[model samples]
Target chain A: MKSLRTFIPIIILLVAWEAAARSGLWSRIVFPSLVNIGREFFLFIVQADAWEQIWTSLYRAFGGFALAAVVGVLLGMLMGRSQLVAGLFDPLFSGTYAVPKLALFPIFIFVFGIGSLSKVALIFLECLYPMVIMTYHGARSVNRVLVWSAENMGATRGEILRRVVIPATTPYIFAAFRVAVPVAMIVVVITEMISSADGLGYLVIYSLSSLRTDRMLAMVVVIALIGYALDKLVVLARDRLIYWEKLDTYYV
Target chain B: MPHAQRLAGAGLLLVILVAWQLAALRGLPSYLLGPLEIARHFAAALGSQELYEHAVASLLRALPGFALGTLLGITLGLAAGIARSFDELLSPLVFLTYPVPKIVMLPVFMLWFGIGDLSKILIIALACFYPTFINAYYGARATPRILVWSARNMGAGEALIFRRVVLPAALPLIFAGLRVSLALSFIVMFATEMINARSGLGHLIREAENGLRFDLMYVSLVSIAILGYAGDRLLRFSRRYFLPWEESHA
Candidate 1:
């Protein structure tokens, strides 16, 4: 009964979509039938060009995310542990937090070139904010009692950080990663769509321009699946690594 | 001491700007303008109608989309939080699509709604929906059970309990969601405009990029920065006003 309830809305949506497609109220271009979209999706998955586009987008997203995770965590940890560092960098992040970093894309293109480099860099910058902010919060809020206990046990700074601080911050880091991974995907796709010769985003544009709405919808599905899977992957990793902390938030 | 620290912070930024200007004096790419030059350009543009027009266009697209998306998100999210059937029916779908970038639908939107303000507005609305929905949902769900019980015991009806208890409790998180979606609305608005638009800061920047008008590019960038910062401040202020009992903290 519980499982059935979960699928009910999805079933209704699909049925409604199919009905809309068959109702002939609009052109097929506007509402491609599920069967057509499914066929196109199948065709796309089997195509080498589609695989290449997927790989291009995936690598760009992953490259940027990996870079952000490393830098953001290190900087966040530094800021968390040191008041001076926090004082110095906190304003920099928060003040510019509202600014759309996408505004800098044109400059990035000139500096990094109109290739995967620019896309990856933009993704890195975009993903960096959430990671650093979340990790900083987590690291800063590690219980004072835990630190005091660790010190009382004659633990070194390194030992205390490794045994106590890192563990406490792990959950927050994962939380940041969860927020960031999707952002990375979003940036990659947006950048690619804005300027790129190849990638899933580019393919979507390409299909749309060619008036292949069905194929375009198929690409959308592929992009959505990749996004959904990446999110689920992060949740799985978080659960495995931070087993002690159950992610009860709807965010996951 | 706190004032001194803030000055120190500004000092660092000032130093970076100075260094950048010095570097430009030596030699830098044409695409890269010094801070002073950029500021001068921004000032010049401020005197012109072009900047205002584009900024207004951008705001028109961003604000309406934001209002619509947040309104729907808050209503549905709160409903789902209060009712079990709605929760089961809607939440899974929302969560599943939560991570999917809604920008991919822009082309489809353009196809369906025409390549006009409607498409841009709808895309922005779609992008703004997720954060607000999730935040509002969590905010309502996290309402204190004890408070609800007390209200019930006091003979308060369901509507009364919701209005007095749930709404207030959810306001903070709802504000957080609004803050996030406000940022997102600008982003999606900028992106859609950049991708394809006749006017707006994004379009202006794109034009500058293609025309190699570094001054115009910087002007547009500064305009967007100012707009975004101002909108954020406005939201923060409103949040404080609405939730007076909740302490203002970043």
Candidate 2:
């Protein structure tokens, strides 16, 4: 029953989409039939070079994300643990938090060239803020009582940070991942769409330019699947690691 | 402690600026401009009519899309939160596609809606919708049921309860969503403009890049940055004014 409930809305949307496609009111290009899209999707997956495009996008997103994770956590940990670090860095992140970092893409392209490096760098910059802010907040708000108890047991500062602070901050780090991963995907796709010869985003633009709406839709589905899979992967990891704390909140 | 912290942050910023300027003085690349040089270009641009034209165009696209998206998200999300049938019917679809980048829909939107501002506006709306919707839904759901019961016990009406109790509780999360979507609106607006547009800061920056007009690029960059910062500040101040009883922690 639960599974059925989950699929119900999806079924409705698919039905509505098919109906629209068959309505004959609009051109086939405007609303490509699902069968056509599915065929293209199948075709896309079987093509050897298509996988390369997917790989290009995946590497850019993950590479940037991984770098940001390491740097953001370290920086956040430093800020959370040391007042001086927080004082020095907080304003930099928070003040520009509202600014669209996409503005720097032009500069990044000039510096890093029109290759994947610029996209990766942009992703890193975008993902860094969320990770730092979330991790810092998580680390800052760890129970003082727990630290006091650890101290009473004669644990060193390093031990406390490793054992308690890290575990406590893990949930928040995962929350940041939830935010960052999608953002990385968004940035990669946008950057590639703006400027790239290959990648799923490039494929979307390329197909559209050639007026192959079905192929383009197929690419969209591929990007959507990869994005959805990455999110599910993060959730699965969080569940396995943070078993003690249920993710009850809808918003992080 | 707060005073010292402010001083440290400001000091670091000053150091970075000075270092950048010194680097420029030592003959940095043509593509790079010093902070002062960039400032001078921006000041000069400020005197020209082109800056305001592009700024206005950018805001026109961003603001309307933001307003439309947030309005629909809040309304639908709050409705879903209060009613189970609507929730079960819609929640799955929303959550299912939540991770998918909405920007990919731009091509399709263009094909269907025409290659104009309408499609761009719709795409921005689509991009901004998710965060606000989810946040508002959660906010409404998180409202204390006891308060609702108390309101009923005190003979308050349904609409009154909704307006007086539910909306207030949901405002914080809604505001959180608003901030996210607001930032998102600027990004999507910039992106759509960058992808294709004759006028706007995004277009200006792209044109500058292609022409190797480094100073013009910085001028557009700085303009968007200031606009983003100002929009964020305005939203924060409004939140404080409206939700005075609630601490503005987030």
Candidate 3:
């Protein structure tokens, strides 16, 4: 019954869209019928080249995201534990936090070349902020008494970090992951749209320019599904990895 | 401790600038401008009409969209937060589509609304909506249950309780969301302009790239960076005005 409620609005939207498509008040280009879009989507998905495009985008997003995750967590942990590092870095991050790193893409294209490397680098740069910021806050705010207790118990620094600090920070790390994953996807699509020979974003642009609105909409749907799935993947991982803590306050 | 720490931070920034200047002296790449070189170019451009034209164009695209999106987001979000039926009807759609890059809708919007500032503004609004809505919803949801009960016990009406208690409680999170949305508005604005615009800093950079006007590129980059930083500072400053009782996030 609860699940059924969720479908009502979506169904209404689809129905309304189909009605508009058939209403004949507008051209077919404006409102491609859903059936046509579905057929185009199916055709696109079945192609071997389509899978390669998907892989290209996925790999680039992941390459940058993985680099960011490792570097950001380590840097964040250091900042959290050491006042010198915190004082040195916090202002830099906060001050530049609102600046759109996307603006750096033109320069990146020159330095990294007009290829996957620059896009990947940009993705890494964008994703790094959330990871570092969240992890720093989490690690800094860890219950001080827990650290004191562990110290009194004669636990080594490494042991204390592993046993207490990491456990406490895992929730934050996962939260950062949730934010960064979509960010990676957003950067990938934007970069590809701006300049790329191949990728889902390029394909969408390609279809539109050719006036294949149905095919273009199909690609949009595919991108949306992939984005939705990636977000779900993060949520699933967070739930599994951080079993002790429910997802954080921001989550529904 | 605070004084020394602040000095150390300043020292680090100074060191970075000097190192970049030295690297340029040693022949940095043609594409990469030195800090001082960029500064000179930006100062020169500051005296020109071109920079102002582009800056105004970009702001025109970004600000209206930001206003429209945030206004709608706050209204709907607050409604959803307080009303269960509204939450059930609306939230699932918002969450499901939240991760989808809203930029993809640009082409569609362009086709529908025409290839003008209107499409760009609408796309920016669409991008800005999610963060504000989610933040506002959560803020409303996080209203203290006891406060609501106490208001009701004291014979406060529903409308009065919402206006006095719920709105105030939600202000901080809504502001946080606004900050996020404001940042997003710039990003989407920049991206859209880069993708297709005759004017704006993004366009200036793209034009400079194609024309190999390295100084122009740096000038545009510097301008946008300053604008972004200034906008953030302005937002933070205004938050204090609106949220006098709340602790500042900074």
Candidate 4:
């Protein structure tokens, strides 16, 4: 019953949308009926081409995300642990944090070619910032007492890092992951939308140009579901691994 | 050793640039220009009025949308976070759709708002809205409960408590959200312009690419980097000024 209360607004919105669609006030193109959209959405799931496009987008997003995860964590940890590294790389990352790396896509196209490579590269650049910055903070602020205790107990440097620093920074790593995953999705979609013949984003643009509003909406739904599911998957993983803490809120 | 390390970093950058320059010197491709040549072209373009006009156009779309979105997000999110009734009415919607790429609504927005700056601005605003709202909500919710209770016990009214206790506590996270929104505003603006636009840095880059003006492409890219960096610095400055007690998070 409590859960139902939370869904009231969503239900009302759907009802309003259906009513508006059925009223004949706007063209079907402007607001496709929910039934038509649902059918198209179902068809989209069953279609091989749609699956391929979805896979293409997923691959690009994950490719970049994985690369960022590896490189960002390493760089972040180095910066956090070494003052010299921090002084050098900190300025670079924080300085350009606000700059939209998307502006380099044209150059990337010229260098990496107008294909999945360019899109993934851009995604990697975009996702790297939050991951690195968040992880740097996490690693840098690991409790000094924990490290001292581990050393006092005759733990080696590697042992201290593996047992203490890693555990301490896990929450922040997960936080960065949450931020980077959505960023990966956004970058992939943006790049594909900007220039691509395949991927879900390209499919969206293609559907729109063909005046297939229902299909476009269905694709949008699919994109949203993918994004939401990826986020849930991250949360599930974090919950299982870092069971000591619960994610009480969404934003880091 | 510190000086040596600094030199090593700078040397690495210099080596990369020299290698690229050397590669271009050997006639790499029509699309690829040397760093020196690109820098020269960017300098030349800076003297022209076209770049300024495009930069202004891009800024007009991004800044206004960023401001509007952050303003609305902070206001609504703070209210919702503080008031249970508002939270019940709005938070579910926000949280459920939080992961959904707000950019997908660009088409629908374009249909409703027309294929002009309005739609672009609104879409950017919509994108910016999520981070700001989420951050502001969390910030307000995370306000020290002890502080609020003490204020209440001291006979502070609700409005006073909110203004004196909640807003200041929430300001840091709100600023963090603003930074994200600012970056997002630029990305969305660039995307919309790239996909379709008469003028802007994104449009400039696309035109330059299509016209085979590699210099212009680099010029637009550098201009965007400067704009983004400057905007971030400005935000950080304001954050420091307003929330002097809080340490820099970004």
Considering every candidate listed, which one attains the maximal DockQ? 2
Q: For candidate 1, report its TM-score.
A: 0.98
DockQ of each: 0.65, 0.71, 0.62, 0.55
Tally clashes: model 1.
0
Chain A TM-scores for all candidates read: 0.97, 0.98, 0.98, 0.97
Model 4: CA > 4 A from native: A247-252, B1-28
Residue by residue across A1-252, what tens digits does model 1's lDDT show?
Answer: 888788888999999989999999999999999999999999999988778889999999999999999999999999899877777788888888889999999989999999989889999999899888888888899999999999999999999999999999999899889889988988888998899999999999999999899999999999999999999998888888887776545332
lDDT of 1 by residue, B1-250 (tens): 2776677678788888899999989889888898889988989999999899999999999999999999989999998888988898889999988989899999999999999999999989988888888888999999999999999999999999999999999888899889889888999999999999999999999999999998999999999999999999999999889999988865
**Considering TM-score, which of the candidate structures 2 and 4 is the better prediction for this target?**
2
**Which residue pairs show collisions in model 2?**
none
TM-score-superior candidate, 1 or 4: 1
Q: What fraction of the genuine interface contacts, i.e. the true contacts, does candidate 1 reproduce?
A: 0.62
lDDT tens digits, residue span A1-252, model 3: 999999888889999999999999878998999999999999999999999999999999999999999999999999899889987888788888889999999999999999999999999999999889988988998999999999999999999999999999889888888888888999999999999998988888888899899998998998899999998898888887888776454421
Ranking by DockQ: 2, 1, 3, 4
- Over the stretch A152-213, how does candidate 4's per-residue lDDT look in tens digits? 99999899889888888878889999989988998888888889999988988889999998
Q: What lDDT does each candidate get? A: 0.90, 0.92, 0.90, 0.89
Clashes of 2: 0
Which model scores highest in lDDT?
2
Question: Which residue ranges in model 3 land beyond 4 Å of their true spot?
Answer: A249-252
